[model samples]
Target chain A: MKKLWISLTYLVFIVLLIIPLIRIFSGSWAEGWEGFVEALTRPQSLHALWMTTIIVVSVTLLNTIFGVMLALYLVRATWLGKRLKQLLNSLVDLPFAVSPVIGGLMIVLILGPNTIMGVFFEDIGFKVVYALPGMILATLFVTFPLMVREVMPVLQEIGTQQEEAASTLGAYSWYTFWKVTWPSIRWGVIYGVVLTVARSMGEFGAVLVVSGNIMNKTQTATTLVYQDVENFNVLAANSVALVLAAVSVGLLLLMEWAKKRKGH
Target chain B: MHIEVSNLNKHFGDFHAVRDVSFTIEKGRLIGLLGPSGGGKTSILRMLAGLESPTSGDIVFHGKKVNELPPQERGIGFVFQNYALFKHMTVYDNIAFGLKVKKQSKDQIRERVMSLVELTGLKGFEHRYPHQLSGGQRQRVAFARALAPEPQLLLLDEPFAAIDAKIRHELRTWLKDMIERLGITSIFVTHDQDEAIEVADEIMIINKGRLEQKGSPWDIYKNPQTQFVASFIGESTIVEDVSKLKGFEDASVWPGTKALIRPEYIEVGKRSEFRIASATEPGRVKHIHFRGSEWMVEVTVGDTTLITYRSLEKEVLQPGDEVSVLVHRAYLFNDNDSWIMENKLKEDPMPIHI
Candidate 1:
């Protein structure tokens, strides 16, 4: 019976994961290696990849700084009332509770070109919808919780003893943070950053609604792959999907490494 | 440094942690705050270190009120109960943290750190992380780090609570001697009476968020001002009716009476071995416990069980054996006060009849 169960698990894994991955790999090279290289190096494909890179970098950086600060405040701040802290703590999980499509639609409804805030931003020489900033904002909203969730547990585990020790030893507050708290929570922060990067890289639903998938302007890699699939350009779509898959696999490896370091 | 705390009180929402507690410490004196768990011993220590702000208090250091000073500016060193050593840093870095924070020169930092490393006997373990060291070694590292900055006052919260029993004993003596040599005013908190008595130049007894008593170890042990101190400082048995005992028959002076009898105050022996056989009462040995180099014997006399120690060299005592027991003194207390009652028979011995 055990042998049959193990066989069934392996069969399910192959059918669900291995088969699709193999198909994508073979489909990307259907027109041979030259065709695969040409498909990826096209101007539109390069622009989409570049846009995705920019979004991932900005989202990961901003999320890391603000997420760590929020985690610290939620866990360590004494000035906040107990009820307020509890409310804020529950609100952090709102991104995870709301579907990404709904999140994107919410942002668009509140900050679209016709909206008051959007017009004000446009008057100030900034744009919100169908722009890079809007795309970045949508990705940020989706990935914000990843960094905070990873860091909050670690902060709670380490406690405040070391920081108190530092303060009593004549170290200032910022110095204590740099010397004592940072070293203890670095691995958790790294894990959060990796998750944020991975999430922003493949954020399709929100980016599509916010960016409108304009060619050579606001088009991201995931949206470009959607456009290719809609136009029945199977090989081009497969090429972009393969790149995203490779990067995702690499990020998964990084996450595993970070998790191991954190355990220590 | 001399320190004075007047009317210090700490309240955590509805729970009163420290209630109008006040005390003073002389320069270069080693003070111990001794109490049971959740008895406000640690709360007082933290308030002194500025780690916890008192709800209302005046912490005057050498006559300068410092209630508003942050911990960093208090010029105090605090060692946590768990050591709280920086897990990521090596021993050298941990010891140098305070110096670096002060922006001291590299040469001065190295000189001071090396001296501390030698003083702490951590010569070869300079590069090892806190996790790589044993519990005792980690404690020594924490001590060295706290001393590195040359703070005027040192506060330690249960400094040896995390180490093994054997190591804890050795470190107690070592710490007392080190503090004496440095002549730095230090205060440590511990729930263990033995630890407090052995290491503290003066011990303060705290109970239920109140300071019960404070005095030298000998003074506190011999003359406890309150009932809590009398029962807490030694291995004592509380007797409801001490008046039933022959020598303490007059203990009824204190209404609603109770008495604390320590092990040393009771003498147990065979009838022929007693110095005053007429004054001794017959007791039955209830239990005998072997406590290295001596024996702890529990005897029942007139429905009250008393604990006393017997030398191992003497005739061995067994359970169910009848022994003569004489109580030298007992601390009799009422609701508001306590007093020492001596054996009235000892003042006037009975004439020997042939």
Candidate 2:
């Protein structure tokens, strides 16, 4: 009976997850690899992939630096009061808790052409909403907590003893951080960046609200998939989505590998 | 370096950790700050190492004030209780970290680190990370890493607390020798009285954020200046209200003062053999514990119980045996726990009438 129950549970898992994934993969190749390749090679689709790569790379890079700084401040520095520390700690997860569409709307409201800051940017001849900058801001807003959450637990685990030991060994503050603190948290930062890339690559709701989904201009891979599906171009939609799925799968594998390595 | 800490006080929000703690250290001597957990020993060590600023006191290092200097500028080497070796770095790199940060040439750093590796007996293990090393080896790495910068003074917080008990003694002796060989002033914090007594040149005992007493190990053992020090550093039976005892109600005795009687000073023997048999108080042996090399016999004298040690090779005394206990020496402290005077009990010739 126990064996039967366990096998039934495994069957349920496969039916719920593996079936849909297999259907998507087989459906995308209904015509052939040639048609899928053709869909990915189109100028508009190519531009979407490029836009995604730009947003994902830039957002991950910026957040990695800021995230590590924030984690260090939260874990090591004692300058803030207990209540303020708790407030900052809770606020780090704001990106995770807020809906990505709402986050995008928040960005648009602040940087839209009609707002004071938006007019100031317009006077400076810089476009924000319905542009690359606005899309990047939305992506950044959704991915801000990835690196910090990954690094914070590791920082708290490693503690400040090594840094204190470094200082007592005549190491200056910056050198101590670079030599002692950074190495311990490097793997955590890498894991966070991997997750950040995966999240930003698939981000649609927020980027769609901000980018206006202009073809060959502000369209990202996810938005392009949505547009292709709306136009009943199933092959184009499946192909663009397949690329993101592949990247996400690869990153998930990398995260698993990192977890195993950390175990050792 | 000779260091002087005057009126050091540390308060962590509402908790007063270290209060008015002051002490002076002579150059090139190893000192131990002995206290229980949350007793402010670590706080004092941190203040001395410039890790934590004292709320209202001055730290003078070699005649120069260093209260405002950061830990890196304090010219002090600190070894954390867990050793805090850089886990990601090789032993060689960990030792060379400070020199590298100081911008020494690559060759110079290598030379210094290699010498430390040999000095710390870690030559073959220099390529391994901290995780690969044993507790004792990791402790040596921390010591070498701290010493690489040629710090004026060394501060260690519970250095042996992480090591295996079997090797802890060996490491303490080795550390003491290494510190003496280096001829640098050093201070370590430990809660273990035996560790402090066995390793340190001078022991400063602290309790509840207050400095109880500071002296050489023998001096502290023989002459603990406070009731807390007497009870903490070694075992003793505290007799409160000495007037309640049979022979201790003399007018010369301070009224209602507490007295500390060390176990070793209370000899257990037959009453007839005592020089002044009248002064020997009769007691019952409540229990006898074999301590491998000796026997610790618990004697119930009147309303108090005192622990007295006997040699394992001696004739075994069983429980419920009636014995006579002679008080050889005791130290009296005032009700406030401050030391007053040592009383060497003179044998009374006349038998006391109850």
Candidate 3:
């Protein structure tokens, strides 16, 4: 009975996953290579894709490093900063709880020429609002928690024993970190980075608020998709949405693969 | 290779984990730092290895102050209770890690690791990760790793705790041979008195962040200085009436005192010689546990059940024999025993770590 139930579950999973890919494959069948070529060569469409890739890659790299550092700091540090660390750790879900538009607005309010950061940056001939930096800030805010969430528990569970053992064995702190500590957390960090990339790719609301949706440079894939729909270009919007979906599905699958390899 | 821990202290928030623990260990000695759980054995080892800082004192290794040094800078190898092997690395890499960190020549590292692995009976298992090894095998790997570095001092934090009972004795004997062969000053932390007796040159019984006694294992076993040491090191039947021993003038015997006796030392004799209130019964023997040399006999002493092990060569008492047990070489400790007062531990001996 248990075997029968397991087989049935797998059968259902295959159907659920394969059905969508089949629809996607079948949907693009009529359009073929000509549509694919057109989608790739079109300047506005292709440039938007390039911008999206850049935003996702840059924002994700920044978030992964900072997130891991934050996790290490929170776990290892003993000071008056602990209460603050707890508050910051819980701040990961701030994006999920608050609307993305509000997060964007808060950045604008705090650093948009009228606020102290904005006023200070203005004096230095820099701007956060209506700029690429602003877009990064939005993505960073949304994705900050991903890597930390992945890495912290692994660090906690695997613990300082191996690291301390390494240290006592004559490896300096940094050597112990890379040699003993990093291997255990590397998979978790990769999963986090992959998630951050996917989330940044489809990040729309806050980037829309901050980017001002500049047609060629600042507009990201999700923002461009929104722009296309608003401009009554439904097919173009569908194309970009499908691309985002494809990337997300591909990376999520990569995460699953890494997880399987680790499980073994 | 004398290692001295001077005024080493650690605090976890308001709780003082180790308080002013100080001990001097001579070279080529295997000392067991014995304590019950939460007695701060692990903390003291961590400080000695520089994994933790002494909140107030200094550690001197071979006449050099090492308190400010980080763990890696202190050429000491520590084995954790669970044997914290580098899981991602193969057994070869795990054993060679300490030497490699010191940038030993590759050939030297290989030779050292291979020899240790061979010694540990893990020769063919070099390529396997920690997960692929059994608990006993993992413990050997930990020992191999610690020994690979040729440390002046080796610290083992309850290395045999994770093994199954059947393997514990065998593994412990193997460890004793290895540590003895190395001739490195070593301190092992354990709460089990049997393990300490089997392996250590000296045993220091700790209770509530204080050392109760530091002496040869035999000194501790035969003449436990404190009640805390007596109970923690071995199973003892302590009678509060020890101060009322036949001799009253001895300074060793004090008022409100107790006599702690290990059951094995108690010899059964006739009713005429029995001092404590006693009773005898005739009933079918329910059970006996076979301990290689002796058989632990369980019999009814009236309403209460008592256990006493006699030589296996001695005639096995039949199901319905009336027998008497005698108390010999019982330890006397000052009584007025209260756990709260015991923890207060006034004028306690300083902790010593080698």
A-chain TM-score of every model:
0.98, 0.95, 0.85
What are the per-residue Cα lDDT tens digits for candidate 3 across B1-354? 798877777888789988777788999999999998899998888888887777788889889998888887777889998898999999999998888877889999888888888888998999999999999999999998998888888999998899999899999888888889888889999988889999999987777887778899888766666677777776756555532322222423356655555667555433454444232223334356788988777655334344567676666765556666433345655545432111111222464557
Model 1 misplaced stretches (Cα beyond 4 Å): B349-354
**Which residue runs of candidate 2 sit more than 4 Å off their true CA positions?**
A1-16, B244-247, B251-253, B336-354
| Collision count of model 2 | 0
> What is the descending lDDT order?
1, 2, 3
Better of 1 and 3 by TM-score: 1
Per-model TM against the reference: 0.97, 0.94, 0.85
Tally clashing residue pairs in candidate 3. 7
Enumerate residue pairs that collide in model 3: B22-B351, B23-B352, B257-B335, B267-B326, B268-B324, B268-B325, B268-B326
i-RMS, each model, one decimal: 0.7, 0.9, 0.9
Candidate 2's TM-score reads 0.94
lDDT string, candidate 2, A23-102, tens digits: 66876798899988899999999999999999998998888889889888988789888899999999989988999999
The residue-level lDDT of candidate 3 at B24 comes to 87
Question: Runs in model 3 with CA error above 4 Å?
Answer: A1-40, A79-82, B242-255, B270-307, B315-326, B335-354
| Location of the lowest summed lDDT over 10 successive residues in candidate 3 chain A | A21-30
Cα displacement (angstroms), candidate 2, residue A54, comes to 1.1
